[model samples]
Target chain A: MGPIMDLTIFGFLVQDGLTTGAVYILLAVSLVMVFTVTRIVLVPQGEFVAFATLTLAGLERGDAPGLAWLLVAAGVLAFVMDLSAARRRGSRRGIAAAAVLFLAVPAVLAAVALYGIGASTPLAAKIAVTCAMVVALGPILYRVAFQPMAAASPLYLLIAAIALHFVLVGAGLYLFGPEGVRTSPLLDGSTEVLSMPVSVQTLLILAASLGLNLALFAFFGFTLQGKALRATAVNRRGAELVGVSADYAGQLTFALAAAIGALSGVLIGPVTTIYYDSGFLLGLKGFVGAIIGGLAAYPAAAVGALLVGLLEAFSSFWASAYKEVIVFTLIVPVLLWRSLAHVAVEEDHD
Target chain B: MNRRNKSACAAVLMGLSCLAAGSAQADITVGVIISATGPAASVGVTQQRTVPLLPKEIGGERVNYIVLDDASDTTTTVKQAKKLISDDKVDVLLGPSLTPNSLALIDQMAETGTPMISLAGSGAIVEPVDDKRRWVFKTPQSDGQMARAIIQHMTSQGIRSVGFISFNDAYGEGWAASFRSLAEQVGIKIVASERYQRTDTSVTGQTLKLISANPDAVFIAASGTPAVLPQATLVERGFRKPIYQTHGVANNDFLRVGGKNVEGTLLPGGPVLVAEQLPDSHPAKAPSLEFIRLYEALPNAGMRSTFAAYLWDASLILKAAVPEALKTAKPGAPAFRAALRDAIEGVKDVVATNGVYSMSASDHLGLDSRSRVMIRIENGGWRLVP
Candidate 1:
């Protein structure tokens, strides 16, 4: 074969890379957030993405997804747990708050979902409901799976997260079946850039990713709750000593991660077909991006994800069979660099 | 003796008589292993659903089937095959959906002296007439056969050059190899070749490179829904040339997932996909329609797929073979398995849902060009083309 390099091909590859990289950036950022705050790898972050896309797809067909029921069930369980804890503490006000937030909110949402089934639902309503349902799952998952084990070591937390990942995948398969689904594009049409056509959906993904990153920046830099999360991330015991509840910070971080993952799902749902098991591979790619950032810096992770995407795009052109290998091999050097640069700190065993 | 002792002795005698009667007519068990929950799950799910459609009785003996999930993994397929042979003692084996899984189970099938009628498309599963492959047969048309149809179509359309993107696996490699050799014979140039993982989310870069090569058409060798990714990207990036797919994506899931982007794409598939559109005199028409009728009548059958038709054809082969095999030997014996394999190979001019099967010692696939027809996707449905 002869060399067939050209500017148009290069430009298109870049455009495609960026479109895919946008999703990875969101995932990498979420992974960084959850890992920093909770010390868990959050392996099932991609399940939230699949659920979001499938829920929107169901809504598009004028059917309510089983996700609504899952949310309500989780909510009721959490509510009952909170209610009992409040009762034991003799705090009536805490019980009321728990009931309204967990029980009332999910019940109303489920009612809305039931009403929308078999009736043509507006696109915006569908999008909102999909996003909200996926976001709601994060805290509930955290409460049910991680709360009791919050004080455990990172290894235990990782095992729990991995187990949750498998369970969620099984549930996703049971709920969605084995077929892959593709939703209608949020934006349709294309524009010529440098003699190369770019899709409107691609542009939307880029815009949404950038906008979310900016909003996250403001949240982390200015808000009190954000500061509390940062404090907990920096020093969990220190934050607890200073009256910042580590448990609350962990829940908040999980919610933000889930929201980011779901938003990423909605953004990319039209561009690719997603099966129930698709998210695991997608999330692993993002985890690779997170690893590239040393698992700490958000901006570094974002840039690293973009690089991973671009590498994958170009490598496919050069050697498509080994493209995955090329993309994953990038982590080796980053790991080597990090290990050489930083000294290892030994942890005390209990 | 007391009256109670006399009654117990009578009951024991009756139980022994029942056991003897059961031994005279034993049930024939067919073991099946398909990729029910992995990358090839879409194809396997369809094939799995067709199990219930199989005949309850074959060769005047009751038939029992034991199905297991391979999850699209080769190791799992081998394990399942072992379990079926040693534990279930199945008389015949049915499936393992994808090419790799089917290829992986060949040795085990031979060792166990059992016949496996695979649902995969790889010709290697039954080619070369090796000891291992002699025990193996497949329902789907071989990649070599489908490649000939595609090359014929391309040459007829005056296409001289084509690009290729295949999965980075055995299935893709098999098709690419066949297409390359066949295209070369027909004087068609393969301008570019690329491969991607089945789990890959994007193929834009590969599509870009192929577009740059400027082939008259592009052949995507991937299977299932993942096959749509590269083709969809090609259209999105303004590659207006004709695109072709193999028989792998001949199902409703591909159409549903590809949506409008796949409209007008061409591929070669079994006659069953367009059974209603085939000429009345076509050899596969009657059996194809019969399968469609029976399959569609099942509750929650959804759309009929060529993969399922392969299983339906397997059932037909087994129906014809079991009676002959039973005449020679009893079930659960090595002689019975050998008899079954010989009977399947001796099947001649047997019309099936996919095509007329004429298995022989040297040729196990038994499918010819008559089994394949070119199809185009138009208006979200398959349209037959000359």
Candidate 2:
């Protein structure tokens, strides 16, 4: 017999959708932020999530995460580039600042990864180390991979991002092995809510998502760096004229994207088993949301992603085999509406 | 002067004899295609690791293996298979490490008249013994054989209805098809059926649907760590019924990933899973223990994998058939390839790590009832279900 539609089932499905949607929201916001600021779609956003989860898993197992070494390597590359650039400019203070950001920070984290984080480490310490290790890579990646081609076309940047995604995925496999991992839940047990069972982990996820989004709103609406990023997104030439360093904006955007991705991973790790390449599909789903927003609107992307999550849940219940098809097919009508609503503009070829 | 002259003469004689033997018997080349780097890497890496452990020389002729990674792509698998057959001219081919890849290679194998020993799980790799599959053989136990074992266990447990969740691909679909037919024979009903992608992050809706149907048990037909998602979700959602899994999750990774969620899961798997637990009288016991000993002795051995055992069995089959093929024709010739295929088909009572293989014209997989045992996950390890 097929499942009968019932209130309990609907509640469970909604809870599931919201939980997954929360993680997708974090990813969608990051995707939009990076896309708007850098003119590059961050295809490797999912890698950050996978790396964070796997890093925590590695810490739980008491093995030093291989990602730390990657951070060190990237740090060295970025440092060299910065040192050379600073030397050409003949700025001693810039050299010192570069040394601090690109060298000292990664070295300290690498040391922590090597010695401090272990099986006996506290959960908070482990998560802190995991996030620091992953988040630091973001700026390093920007400086090393994207800075040189900051003036390149979006399509060219898109190709580089895709290539970067493959590199990270391959590196992830080497670091985490081929097996999937799921962390122990941050909080244990479930309780009744509205006559339905609600997991504490689900509550934590919802709370974290809400808190992070609020923090993001406050940062963007209040902070000078955030306004600079917004200015850079609106027009790089105008932002440069207004004394906003476009380079700093790109680096700051990448840092935020990585932090959001890492947090998403931390929350999602306990809920699902994640593999090295699991990021691509997760990122692709968020991308469907980013597309729904035309890659420019944050609230729209968030809403679109949640809708995608709800549609996924309902379709899985109704036609489990075609859930992916149904979920992805949503973009068709959305793209159609968006294109029809807006008139074509003159080409702004760079 | 006498010592130096005598040593020189002995070295010359040894070199002459080696040359003669080399001219007399050409080295046998066995080409292997594995999905060592992509989605199926969990399965394929173990099989790839077992390659170096395979015999370097079978029947006194040096065996050289040319292993290629398919990266878990079907087109890449076909390309590598063609490269091995036409370029390397391997005497016998082994593995692309997945059902879809193995199925794709059938036409290529048949056209080339090359003998292939697939290491994938699907029985469709060699079923019907048609003109195409006649050249293809596999080492893994068929889905039908394992299905009967599971159905027998369900009957013993007095479970009348079950919920089925499987992957949308061949491995899952093949298991579902076999299990359903067997369940029907025993008058057990499958109350609900669901399919999922391997990479799906959540199965909440599907699990909710299954729970609503309220079967006596849930049967999960999936492989690797992906299989853990459904069982874990079920436990999280308060489904307090028996959960049955197929042999696909017979690896240490699954145990490590599933942890407490997979405790009490019942499955039908190869004898290799519980080698030490098997009674001495069991035909598969000695080979299983021997296989385990060799596997554990490897330099970088981590956890024993059933996928690795399949490759080891493939090697055993190769060792058994190489001498017979040699009797008819020399290595690297078209005749030798045909002879090798015939020899593999004629292999009889070759006890392997999984089971005893007795091949015939009609059956190519060669595994019998002795290959499988009912097992339960107890205290995070496999225990024989009495």
Candidate 3:
């Protein structure tokens, strides 16, 4: 008990917490964006993390991942759907564009992956290729699973998200067996900061997370497309009436969420071992952070995720067995406070 | 006419009796339940691979092995055990790999009056020799034995204080309990003790707390690839003290996942892990070499695992007991199970791949300090240490 309160221990806990918090912050921001624009929780966000890590590991071993094949299949399916829709709507140009973007993009990525296998590719290339492969999965997933049900009730979308999580988890197990894999660190060295040692990989994680957050801020604040997404989040029917394509906003949000999840996977793969089923728990922690922000504000979710990470670190030291319980219990207070502060209003129908 | 009919009746009766005697000497069926697809799959895979290497005929009786996957779930283990007993009518039961799965099937085994040779490492599987556990036996050395070996090594190194990071499961708690009592006996104080889940992504916080205690060494009581998490985190946080792991992680996957981080780490393992490196005069050498030869003969056999040797030893015990049991009662009968149990208990000085096993009414595991050897990870392989 006496040693638990030591300042040095506190500092170490903070460092550890922030390192993990950075990844959770990315996940929380993705969750907030996806929920705000689409009114659906991205339950399978962790699957992207697992796929990215596994893909990187496969590349390190000089083997092409099964994800390469999955991506191509999804791309082909999405293109077929788009082509039929365009033909029905008498838009020949749309069909041609869809074929190039969906079919050609995945075909090129798959070819690169096949060529990279058994070859000594650069690490940056592997990282970029894996991230792109996973991000490319986003639009296809939206077109297949969510786009048709875009106007469904939030409860119905939540159920669909959960179902998608199971499908991805089953697919992950089939693709990457039950064995856990760890990749070599992207940056492999440590340095002392204020008498505390920190690894270069940890620094990379912090920097990358900061960069992504800033990029997201700029994307949402300045770009016309970002404003359209914001308008949809504020009032979906109003945005639709104003000629902003709801489908585009939904697809973009999912794409952003997928990219964030994959990047988080690549960043943390070296820090911890990742298994096929590991993503669900990690994503749940992010969901907890999202809930703390009332599922609306990005900055609040980021701060909440950092707090969750810090609490997790400190509580593990104090009571390791109950650390999960303590971290999850935080949401109860936040929920109670929000419920008491805000008056209930019935949601408007379309 | 009467003499001719009488002679024909005697000949027919003799032929029927001979046929009955031949049918009584049929195959002995051993049902195996192992986790081939879940968290324990790494360990269970090796155990499963050993099944093909078992002798097809034990004492002139053809042995039929029925293997089922429990998926590392305790309820599934019990269900599989029940199905093997009632449906397959297996003469004896072989496994239910992990500790929790093995422990869960104890009652079911006792109720069914079938002998279970478990491959798990927990002492509770055979300890106290209660009515329920009397039907159960395990091949791996008990946690208590390995704990004492670690404590002795620590004492010889002049280590007075140690920290522990254990998994929050039965295996972890079992080691923590044994390690605590053994360290106390050796005058070593436990400075810090922490627990983490097997699926936990990061143990940095727990590891930092452990380092803050400033112990001379830290012992991690986790198994498989997950065991690498805490140790790696400790190194990341710059803890330069000696680190030790439990025998549960004595496999190639641990070394692979751990990479450079686990070099020079110490752990106690079965002699089979570093069989080639052991001295020729060592008791485990001959049997260990034979197991390696037979296992490696199979196409695509990757690396020799100590977990596989546990099943190999179980087969050895079965090989010695099957003949004795066959003499008393036919296979799959109530009397046959009782006889097999007694025969296994009566086995004496049987050299197995892991160690020389000698089971008794009070002792089911039958291995001692001779079964364990201290090992270190050097150059990505297990090195035998003095």
True contacts kept of each: 0.78, 0.84, 0.66
* Tens-place lDDT digits, model 1, residues A188-221: 8998866777888888999999999999999999
The best candidate in terms of DockQ: 2
Residue pairs clashing in model 1 are none
* RMSD of every prediction: 5.9, 5.7, 7.4
> Where does model 2 exceed 4 Å of error?
A87-93, A344-350, B1-38, B48-90, B322-336
lDDT of 2 at B44: 80
- Give the winner by TM-score: 1 or 3: 3
lDDT of 3 by residue, A1-350 (tens): 45566777787788878988999999999999999999999999889898999889888888768888888888898888887777788877667666765788888888888785555668889889999888888877888788879899888999999999999888888788777889878998888888877788888999999999999999999999899999999999999999988878887888888899999999999999998889998898898889888788998999999998889888888889788889989999989988999786444486
Best model number under TM-score:
3
Worst 10 residues of 1 chain A by lDDT: A341-350
What is the descending DockQ order? Answer: 2, 1, 3
Number of clashing residue pairs, candidate 3: 0
Q: Which stretches of candidate 3 lie over 4 Å from their true place?
A: A4-6, A80-93, A117-119, A192-196, A345-348, B1-25
Residues B198-269 of candidate 2: C-alpha lDDT, one tens digit per residue: 899999999988988889999999988999999999998889999999888888888989999999999999
**Alpha carbon lDDT at B98, candidate 3:** 86
Per-candidate clashes come to 0, 0, 0
How close is chain B to the truth by TM-score, in each candidate?
A: 0.89, 0.90, 0.90
Task: State candidate 3's DockQ.
Answer: 0.57
